[model samples]
Target chain A: MNRILRLFAVTLIAVVLVEVGYAIPSFSRKYKTSCSTCHYAAPMLNGFGKAFKNNGYRYPAGTDPEMTKEEPVSLGSEGYKKVWPEAIWPSDIPGTSPLSIWGIGRINYAAMNDVKWEFEFPHEVEILYAGTIGENFSFFGELEFENEDNQNEIMYPFALQYDWSPGLHIRAGMVHADPTPNHLKLTRNHYNIASFRSRNRWRFRDEQIGLEVWGAGNGSGERGGYTYRAGVVNGQGINDMNKEKDIYGKVTYKIGGLGETGGTAGAESQTSEFFIDNSVTVGGFFYKGTASRAGFNDEDFTIFGGDVDYWYDRFIVNGALMFMNSGMPGIPERKSMVYYLQGNHVIYPWLIGLIRYEWEDADTDQDAVKPVNAFIPGVTVMARANVKLVLEFKMFLDDVNKKNDTFTLQMNFGL
Target chain B: MNRIKIVVSISLLFLLSQPLFAGDIKGKVKAKGVKHSGDAVVYIEKIDGKTFDVPKDHAKMDQKNLTFIPHVLPVLAGTTVDYLNSDEVLHNVFSPETCVDKFNLGTWPKGQIRSYTFKKSGCIPVMLCNVHPEMEAYVIVLETPYHGVTAKDGTYEIKDVLPGKYELKIWHEKLKGASVVVEVPEHGEVVVNFDIKR
Candidate 1:
């Protein structure tokens, strides 16, 4: 019965994709522009796209009304700005609905020691809301539904942000704790350093409910500059387990390529935003938090990580190293070291090839056979500006997962 | 024999003396799904045996206040266009359309000018600035000089076109209009109207 159900779902999704016609609309429909303006592929932003995101979902020049095709409905008139304290400040809402629907579906075939080729669909259907409320206020939200263990699992993450300038902003709600540029990766899998959860369930990539101040400064493109973010949160991902708060901070310095806000006038790429990025960005991050359980021994952990990204024309490569320990006050038996190196090249405007090597040493074990060591290779094909397909194979080299290698073919799109 | 030759010469002169027929074509285009009906290029497509002289003076397009002045420009083939940057900041121009050779004009400060000649007819290229992705314009290269730009009221007129059966076409960046077959008579006006849709 489970096998039949999976096959039915795959056929149904394929039919729906064909009937929906070309493109999955989002910002493109609102601004009356093509998806290629921001995305090298769906969800993987390019140089100008980074600037757009950094500027709080509006154009980098700070909320240009002319940038949008439909004029937003004004809550009050522009005259209210001149009157100031005499009247309340006015704002505008999107002329069209801000909500956008997109989804990801994967058909996987796995090979393991005890099982012949098994089938599991890694599925996600999401509704995303993102836009600027006015000149200064912006918000982003994602309501995601996933299929896990033949059950529907749901999660919603959101952020409300305020823009003060091109260089500074403040935000609240679920915000990322690291500055790893995970959105730039072409693969479907998360970086090992970003997702490797300690026994306490502490993860670096998880979004935490928190307040944060972040900024990107210096319009230096080929010349170097920096962007930094810091926040204080309850430490837990979705629910609070204790009254103590967790704090995390990250900073990155870009040595070349397009800057956080813009780029040099003549030096910028005229052909493609993705391929022409030539830069080296080095970053460091840290998170300190404590885990508590009912009638159990408590542990305080501190995680330190460093990463470097190199972009040379059509090629991009990244390396991350992380160390986490609960021995801050001399507690033993809890420590881990992890690292991953990934590289990708844009073979064509519609194709990309990538490979990643991940290694982890958990529980401070010096075992001759490492349990978590693997290599991943993948290719992404963008059939349209909004529809993408990725095929990946994860091969484990350790004694534990040597016979549990997996391969995945995934389709991702957004409207 | 001398008289016969003179008569033949007189008959040939009479045949050559017949005047070429010419007339004006006027029309109105109702464009749907846009604020204005103007900016649509209405022209006669290439007539197999016809050729018109290219205008010697160059057409001008200006970048001022980070906006492209005259968002749409229609020019005859073999005509040169002078792109002028009138803003204080630097700006560059490039088009991705392969029909136009995919040319790029490097960035320059205010008061500088660059030139490109439209050698291919029927090439419509969307012009863009690398520095300002929001800035855009279009250059429509036509094969014949006989064309007219629609007014705010969607009315247009092509004057002194050689009288013949021709295809009168309408082009809008976002709207599709039907082409009409027009038969023009000597010194007379032919009206061809269109209703373009989304």
Candidate 2:
């Protein structure tokens, strides 16, 4: 244990050194704006940040004319005008390569009857590429490294999106299909209810290669509106070995405040006496698929869920509930339920407080693994626009009425 | 000698009062296809071979509740504007328009003020906050000082105008209105009504 602790310390020091010694400016350079323009922190997106992403990594409000001018550097009068493509008429490319890197490090201590501590330097590292090809076409891709397992994985979000209008968009590629509450939260400590082990019984995969159509009404401000997404994907995970495909769809309606109109670009300014913008979104999702297992030929799975997100000023509340039913060849039908509730409030521009409760009942028979319940409270601090620090305390009530707890601290840096 | 002095004082007082007798342009704007008709700037177009003096007092626009107060502001060319922040958050003011040289005032905290002088006339520049993308305001710089913004009821009155024929124009953030030639009488008020549309 002492040797492991020493090793962990060395790795943590190395990661911190790298972060402080090197800096790679990314999207901020492309837009000629600071990271704070879109992000509440390194990865957590504010309202404007979400709109920018919905607009295919382009400026949601509109592009500045001066930022769009491109000057060609020529090697010769008629040959090799420029190696790097400049901003063309409708296309604004700040650099030839639209790529960025994000890295995270973590230190975790767990006490499950016995106390244990571990350190992970570069808990995860991601190479992100995103930009607009033209006025309406955009693309995003990411390659990630998970250091705990010492394995490299490709996040299959390589997708192309075309904006038909502010209210309509079509995209096709690998995408996240899980309708869990934590899927959209920007945090390293994921809700245990959506963990891989839990998902095995639920038969819900996080990412799958698929084609999707999604859109929002009133993309401009945080006003009342609606958004929808529907897609079809391979039932299996990244690599599909089965012939069956999964079908999924989700729809959300927003009330109060400015709707998701895609007009966050300063085109419209609110004049109401109220200083804070408020919005609430209620959504539902349905998924049907067939999961192939080694012992069992195939199991038919159906899952349905609902979620709600509310925002007022700097406070936010999010909750989701999912119910699953599955059938196998010889076994009776199995039913399960999983749900979670989370809330976050911004105490300051650089500080936020969060609380979450998660529960899962894997089997209806009560004989299966005892129902698990977990409570988590955390705080996130922004040292800078691209630097974030999070500390969380988690308490778990496992089956058999056993109590376990964990404490974790994570640091993330992105450009 | 006392009689001559008294006569001189009376003459000067009469001369100053004569300018106050100039006609006033009073009007109401009817905006179509929009929520309210407030913040509409009504001004007189440039007079032939005429130039107005820049005012010594600066106009003010405040940042309150993550918004630029008084969504629309009209000012005479060569006037300086004071941008004040009343909210607890930091705010930035900038213009992407070339007419104002595309000036960007860096972020400032609450209770602080930044000033900028607009030199070019006949240009409407949109002001934006880099920190808050949804915060927006407009500054309409004109050559004449005879301008008034409409109230919530769409009423506006521009006073102390010299009796003459001039082009009157109205500007709205999201609407368009036609410029009309109006002759201000030597005395009393001339009522001009405008129908603006999106």
Candidate 3:
């Protein structure tokens, strides 16, 4: 009896040792990432975050030091580009301490007196990274300006994430909804809703708000391919508040198929603020209006839309058709439909060309005649990783006709 | 004669039934040739026997104040790891290598913990915050049970070794130190040293 008991104990001990031995290295390699990176709290992986990991952590270029331009041999606390065989100077700044800066200035058509010149001072000013304060928290914000104050804004992507399982997660806070079809169209897209609409649309506002929660089917914690997001948000976009209380919900689906051999499909339902990854999306929304003030209606409105997008490595095509109808007392029943087709081609990593055609019509003849057909051809140049310079030529026909066929050069940046 | 026989039998029984216990082993670690402090991870891997009380959690690699602290983490297989962020910004963490499980925690802010359980046993090279491109950490997952880290002065000691043969491993971020096989005799002290590349 004693011998058998001792043998059993020994066997148990052996099993545990083997299990621990096997588990140790596996545990170490499995958690290579910090918890906060994926979770709104910890140990969680959101849609975009998962896509990023699954995509092998490959992101847009010029954003990572390991992938950035090589450093030059120099002698200084702060690196200075020395005029040598390469005819280049060390562009990396000094005393910046965790703050890395990249800037671009274009003095094009200089000889022409109305010189189309633009300066982007530290245009792509992403802080690289500030610091992490604990196992579950950290904070960083980015400020950007373009054309020396023509446009300026700061983006704070504060988030908290926690993992429920290897294939499950929960998160909360303000973070960019996984890039939407509208977002993926890139600025190179000519028919983007933002570029064509004269007034802020209800649906576009839904896609961008302060709070969201998204998940996926695989929950493998990868960053690319098919994924989905559904969330509740402040119906009104940032910096806009009305007397009427509102809650917004959106559902988005994305996938990478044959067309996106080296790219992805992205779309969003404007009516509900839903952003889709890279796929066809169908959406619907309803919102209550605030009391009439300054000729605005107190009656609510309902909006719905279907959008589809296709993307190749460098080429993209998309079309979105939407209907917005308002049912307010006293005002005539108002209904409208807007649709646009856009195409984009990557001329180079830093350069892209776009062409778009859009048409908008309202039941009211007055709304339909406002120069609905527009031809916009534009080019976007990557002045830096997060900074871009665009030159767009706009030609309007019929209705709201004006000689705004002007030359506009602008620079934009984001962190 | 009978007394001597009994003592010999008891000693034999103790040797066979229970492993020997030795002095405490401890150490700190330092980066060999860099002004920047390297993140070092220390762990022990029991070679052949399974010890249930010992944990299998992966050592951690954290980003605080724009730097990866304790950059090196050592662990045995099947351990849980806790990744903490001590910063004032959001970060996305992920690794694409096949040897390790990949995950991206998007936009994590202050006071958050992401945990992962490693099921495979091997070393994995990790990168950080797809959004914040500068942070990095590594997981040195080993199969053996004899692992430990060196002190800031690059010294280490391991104790409580049962009589057995173990391959001692010492690792430093950016440096691959030498590994040696040593036997821990019953209740005896053994000295092992290593020199790493700068």
| The best candidate in terms of TM-score | 1
True interface contacts retained by model 3: 0.00
Residue-pair clashes, model 2: 16
Model 3 agreement with the true structure over A115-229: per-residue lDDT tens digits: 3454444432323222222212222222222232332333333334433322233445443332233224344223434332212234342223444444333211212233334
Model 2 TM-score (B-chain only): 0.91
Model 1: residue A78 alpha-carbon error in angstroms: 3.0
RMSD to true structure for each model, in Å: 9.9, 16.1, 21.9
Cα lDDT tens digits for candidate 1, A338-395: 8999988889878999999999888665465364989999999988767889999999
State the displacement of the C-alpha of residue A375, model 1, in Å, after optimal TM-score superposition.
1.5
Poorest 10 consecutive residues of model 1 chain A by lDDT? A15-24
Report model 3's TM-score to 2 decimal places: 0.42
Please give the ranking of all candidate structures by lDDT, highest first, separated by commas. Answer: 1, 2, 3
Model 3 ranges off by over 4 Å = A1-50, A53-185, A188-192, A195-210, A218-226, A237-243, A255-295, A362-371, A383-387, A412-415, B1-198
The numbered model that scores best in DockQ is 1
Index of the highest-lDDT prediction: 1
Residues B1-198 of candidate 1: C-alpha lDDT, one tens digit per residue:
999999999998976664457799998889888988888889886988778778889999998655687788888999999999875334678888998889997665457788899889989999997655668999899888878888868999998788888888888889998888889889879888889889
Cα lDDT tens digits, model 3, B1-198, are 999999999999988765555434444454557663334444444455555433744567676644566666666666677777654333446776667656554434446666676657656657555533446777676665455555566666655666666666665667766655766666757766555666
TM-score of 1: 0.79
TM-score of each: 0.79, 0.61, 0.42
DockQ-better candidate, 1 vs 2: 1
lDDT of 2 by residue, B1-198 (tens): 999999999999988876755799999999998888788999985888889899999999998755688899989999999999765434679988999998888655457788899999999999998676667999999999889899988999999898899989999989999988888888888999899997
